[model samples]
Target: MSLKVAVIGCGSIATHRHLPEYAANENVEITAVCDIVGERAEEAAAKYQAKAYTDYKTLLKEESIDAVSVCLPNYLHAPVSIDALNTGAHVLCEKPMATSIEEADKMIEAAERNGKKLMIGHNQRFVASHQKAKELIESGAIGKVYSFRTAFGHGGPEGWSADGKESWFFKKDEAFIGAMGDLGVHKADLARYLLQDEFVEVGAFVETSAKENTDVDDNATLILKSAKGTIGTLAASWAYTAKEDNSTIIYGEKATLRLEDDPTYSLVAQYANGETVKYELGAIQSNDEGGQTTTHVINHFIEAIQNNTVPLIDGIEGKKSLAIILGALESVKTKRIYSLEK
Candidate 1:
């Protein structure tokens, strides 16, 4: 049986990732599209042959979709996902799952109470290179990863968001945090996945030195220590005016892994034995190209719902990733290390 799906928030993510991917899934049907901007909703709905809604609550009350994608701004991710879960629909919420820990907790509770699947849209985990890196680490090919550095940066949301800089992305209240939430959250989740460890402590320096007249931060640097004693630096910036750089380097006792860092190879491994292996897994997903290279995220969500299996990135995992970013934010505010224990 095909799954009936509704897409909430017909913005850039919806347009570029969610909607097109859903349309391509033979086991899924786009039942509705909701966005505050009526025209945008209508456009997406018309293309998908689904109803359009200006208010998400009305969509939840009226549509009988089997699943919903919460693609709204960061602030709306929690509430909309909770509402969808309450309405007997599995939810696939966009990342940074919630603005605060309390909100993240409520989202988890609501999904449990409703007995629905709740998956976060941290698509980086689905990347081919990243998956291969995780496999190599698990198989002990890297031999005890000791330290790493990962960064995600672009020329700011103006180059990507549907509404440019004037969009909700620049609004502190709407986005909650800037580069840290928008880009860094993905890396935080990626780190945990690759290392199979949770970050227990974070020391950060988050600043709004770029993107004039915006209250939200445009650049951030974080020092993260995993519970297993792994140390790493995560840098997120909206100041990559020349090019996008989403790269990671993992140094281990035996070898080092480079992901999305080399021009010819998407993944490269250099060992102490003077042997190097280069892997070409194609380019990482970017704004320059859409609709083709997404990380099988939509398909995974459908498989989890249809098979009645827990998604790889569930509520607990999502919350753990969010805690790291939130910890960094607190670290910046207090000018001290933030502990994730509490």
Candidate 2:
């Protein structure tokens, strides 16, 4: 039987990643598409031959959905996902799992109580270059990892959002965060995945300098200390006017590994012995160009449900990543190193 899937948002992420990927999967059926904007919902539903709903609560109550992708604004992630889970449907929630840890915990608890799979849409972890980098790092390609720096930046979300400049991406109440939640959370999660460690301490200087007509941050720089004593810098911004910079460089005792840093190579390694190796794995998906490719998030979520296994980026993993961004926000307010242990 095909998995009856429903997408609760008709925004950029839903249109680009979830809907297309699910539609392409033979084992999946797009049963419904919902959006507050009736036209957007109708358009997506018409394209996928699914029912259109202006309200997600109505969709949940009416449709016999086996799985759901909660792609709403940051504030709605937890409530929508918890509702879907309570309705006995697995949920694939977008990144920045929730506005708060309490909400994240509720989403996780709902999934567990209902025996459903809850996955976060952190696509960076599933990138080809990232996967290969993880394998190489585990194989001692760079020896003992010491420190690193990672960044994810673009012009802004104005062009990408369905609502353009008036989108919820810039609203403090709706997004609860700006660059950090939009881009920083991904790097935080990626760093954890790559290093196989947890961040214990975070300090940051977050600001809303670039964009006008918004109170949320458009730039942020974070310093992180991992549980294993590894330290690194993470930069997330909407102020990169030239080009997107989704890259990470890890320094180790024997060598350095760079992912998505070079224009030509996806992964590059420079050894202390003056040896250089470049792996043309694949291009990292960017907001401006070459992002049409499948993110592998929806397919992986489906497989996890079908196989009765945990998703690679499960609820707990999502919360861990969210905690980092939350910690960074707290650091900004307190002007002190935010400890994740607390």
Candidate 3:
């Protein structure tokens, strides 16, 4: 039985990730696509052979969807996801799940009460390098992980806009926040997956340096303490000029593992026993970052729905990662460290 999907945002993520990946899978069918902009929805629907709608509520009401992917901006995440969950559709929502912990909690509550699977689009977990890192760490090559660091940076998505003009990426009203919400959550979620622990405390410094008109931080760095006592650093930016960078390094008592940097592979693991291992994780997608994230998350959600299993990045995991990022922002505003414990 093929699972029918309805997509609520027809932006870059929907085009690059959910639509294409779902179209490729015989078990999944994208039955409806929605966007506030009718043209955007039309383009996506034409490409994916889905029904286009300007209103997502109508799409949900008419589509008979087995699942939904909410790729809307931050402020809309909770409402859209809760609505979908209430409709009895499993949902995979794009990250920075909500602008605040309160909203994320509501989304989680909706999922639980509705008895539906709710996954977060923390695509970095599905990336080849990160996935391989998990495999290596689980193999016991790196024993008793201690500390870690990760970063995700790139020049602004200015060049990727639909009209080569400013869009919601720079609008605070639409985006809710900037680089931290845009990119930091990727590393936050990735770190959680690699460490297998939820972060409990965060101290951060954030600034808006690149885009003068934007009201949110464009560069931010976070220091985090996990529930298990592991310390980590997460940095995110939209101002890097050279190229994209996403990397993580983990140090364990037995060996060290590096992902996405110092090598194209997942790591350079040097054990205390004078042995070394290199694991290469090939390209996880066809050169589309958001697309890769969307695809991987979707597949996991679909499988979870089918098998009645928990997704790798469930709503609780999403809430935890979002709490870290939100705490970082809160720390910056209050000029003190914020509790992930909240």
Candidate 4:
């Protein structure tokens, strides 16, 4: 029997990533869709032939869902995920897992107690170029990565969010964070995945200079130190008016690897001896490019549920990535380097 699934939020992330991907996956059926805006929920439900719900609580109580994609706002991630897990459904929550680490821990605990899988939708780890970069790094192509810089920037969420400029992404209470949570968390997760290391400390300059009427930050730059003493910068910005910049550069002892830094190649490696190689792996998904047809996140979540296995980006991994952003926010508030060592 096909696993019955539901999408908790009918927002951009759900429309672009979860809904379409789930519809295409033959192993699952879209059972319901929920959104506060009745029209949005109705539209998505009609398109997918699923039930519509304005309240997630009602849907969870009624639907016999086997899995759910919690694509709600940052603040709702933890609670909705916990609720879904308790309802005997595996959950695939969007990025910036929770507004706070304490909330994230509770979500993880709920999943464990319910014996259900909880995965974070950090699609960067599944990108072809990023996966190839990890392979190269693991194969000793880039010897002893010393320093790196990764960035994720765009024109802003107004163009991407389903609600436009009035979106919850600009609200401090609803979103809890701005670019750092939206874009920066992805890079933080990517950096850890690529290096296979954990960040020990973080220092950040998170600000809201670009957008008006928003209590949250519009741009942020974080300096991070890994457990292995590797240092690097991770930048997230909504002020890049020209074009999106999702790129990473890893400086190593023998070579420097660049991922999504060039237009022609998805990944490039330059050796110290003047040899350079470029890989034309597919382009990284971008809002400008109409987003990706499949991010591989939904599929992976389904696979994990079907196989009764833990997802690669499980709740624990999600919490670790969230800690980086939370640490950066604390660093900004306290004007001191935030330590993740504890």
Candidate 5:
């Protein structure tokens, strides 16, 4: 029984990650591709052998879709996702759940109202190296994790967005917050997932240092303190023109773990007792380097629907992570530590 899936907003994310992954998944049949840009939608449809739609509402009304991937701009995420949910389809929305907590709440409500699964596309959780690192941390191999520094940086979305420099990602109105929303949120989610704890306080400095003619910030540094007393820095930058830096360092009582930092190894463990071990999980997926082994996000989403189970990164989990980034933005605005409780 193949699940019929439709992709809304046939942008770079859909083209690069979702559509390809779904094409590979035998459990899903891509029934439709929709985008405001007719050509983009038609192009994807022609390649995937699915129907092309310029209006998502029309697609939702006509297509017999079991699930949909909402890859629209930051502002439209909530509205479009809610519409898809109301149309009786599970939604796998792209990151930074919504511009506001209120919007995220509505999205969750819509899914519950429709009895459909709503999974956020926080693909970092499904990365192979990240999965292995999580396993090691949970196994107590790191021994009482005390601190960490996780970062996601690249040349910027201009180099990757389907529309390039003219994309909505550069518009403050469409994007809301810049690199923090685009890249930092992923690290914020990853930190919460890896630490197995919620971030309680956030202090951040966000600014636009690179990419001219854009109001959005390109570089950001966030100081995060977990509920369990662990503190770390989460950085997001679009100024890494030299190369991408998607690395995390977790320091515990027994050892310090480095992820995606070294050219030779993906995971490196340096122990206090003078022992070094490297785990060869493989490279973290980068936009420039397109050989991503598999995200497994689509696979997990399909399985959850098939098994009547919850997706790993559900709406609530998505909201919690989104809250951290929101807090960071608040921190930048007010020049104060934004506490999650407030």
Candidate 6:
């Protein structure tokens, strides 16, 4: 049976990835789409051959929606996901599940109480290069992975959205944060996914240095300690002038894995026995692949639902990543090490 799917938020990601991918999948049907902007929802629904709604609650009440993709702003993620879970629909929420830990917990609680799957859109795990890195790490090529560094940043979203200033991404109340929420959480999430651990502590600093007159932070740097004793540095900024950059470097006892660097590869294994090899398998850049992050994301969720198992990026996983980012924000304010594990 085809899983009936409703997509909430018919913005860039929906138009480019979610609806299109669902439309291509024979196992799922995108039955509806919702957005606060009625025209945007209508346009998306028309293209995908689905119904349209301005209110997510209205879409939730519609019959036979087995699952939904909550692509709303960061602040609305928990409420919409919780409501969808309560409505007996599995939810695939976009990253940084919620602005606060408490909201994230409530979303998890709702999913548990309803016995529904709640997947987060930390899609980089499915990226080819990242998968390759995970394989190499698990195979011990990267040794113990004692430490790592990862970063993702861009020159802001002026080009993506038709109206840069009017985009909800700049609004603190709507988006919850700026570049950190927009890009940094993905790096943090990808780090956790690759390392197979949770960040326990974060000493961070964040400020709105680049985008003038914006309420949210446009630049952020974090020092994090993972549960596996891996201390890492991460930075996210919206001030980049040239191009988007997403890179990760791992320090293993034997070899080091570098992703998103030039030559587009992972798993450059170095051995103590005087052997150096480069695994030049390329990566799936998030902004590239036709701007298709949720394409791979929704496919994984469908596979999980079909197989009766867990998605690659689940809600609890989402909470873990978001906690690190939030901890960074807290650390910035307190100028102290924020403990997340406790």
Deviation from native of the Cα of residue 59 in model 3, angstroms: 1.5
Clashes of each: 0, 0, 0, 0, 0, 0
lDDT of 2 by residue, 97-164 (tens): 99999999999999999999999999999988899888878999788899999999999999788898
How do the residues 198-243 of candidate 6 rate in per-residue lDDT, one tens digit apiece?
8899998898888866798888889989888999899888887677
lDDT of 2: 0.94
**Residue pairs with backbone atoms closer than 3 Å in model 4 (clashes):** none
lDDT of 3: 0.83
TM-score to native of every candidate shown: 0.98, 0.99, 0.93, 0.99, 0.98, 0.94
lDDT of each: 0.92, 0.94, 0.83, 0.94, 0.92, 0.83
TM-score of 4: 0.99
Candidate 4 Cα misplacement greater than 4 A, ranges: none
How would you encode candidate 4's per-residue C-alpha lDDT over 169-226 as one tens digit per residue? 9998899999999999999999999999999999999889999999999999999999
Q: Which stretches of candidate 5 lie over 4 Å from their true place?
A: none
Residue 195 of model 6 has an lDDT of 88
- Winner on lDDT between 3 and 5 is 5
Model 4, position 71, has a per-residue lDDT of 92
lDDT of 6: 0.83
- lDDT for each residue of candidate 3 in 243-283, tens digit (9 for 90 to 100): 77777889888987777776365567778898988777575
lDDT of 1 by residue, 1-342 (tens): 999999999988999999999988999999999998999999999999999999988888887889999998899889889889988999999988999989999999999999999999999998888999999999999899899999999899998889996989999889999999999999999999999998889999988987987999899999999888999999999998888889999999999999999988999999989999999987788765654677688999999999999999999999999999999988988999998876
> Whole-model lDDT for model 5 versus the true structure?
0.92
Span of ten consecutive residues with least summed lDDT in model 1: 286-295
Give per-residue CA lDDT, model 5, range 175-293, as digits (tens).
98889899999999998888899889999998898889999889999999988999999999999888989999999999998988899889898999999998887667778677466
Q: Kindly give the stretch of ten consecutive residues in candidate 6 with the minimal lDDT sum.
A: 286-295
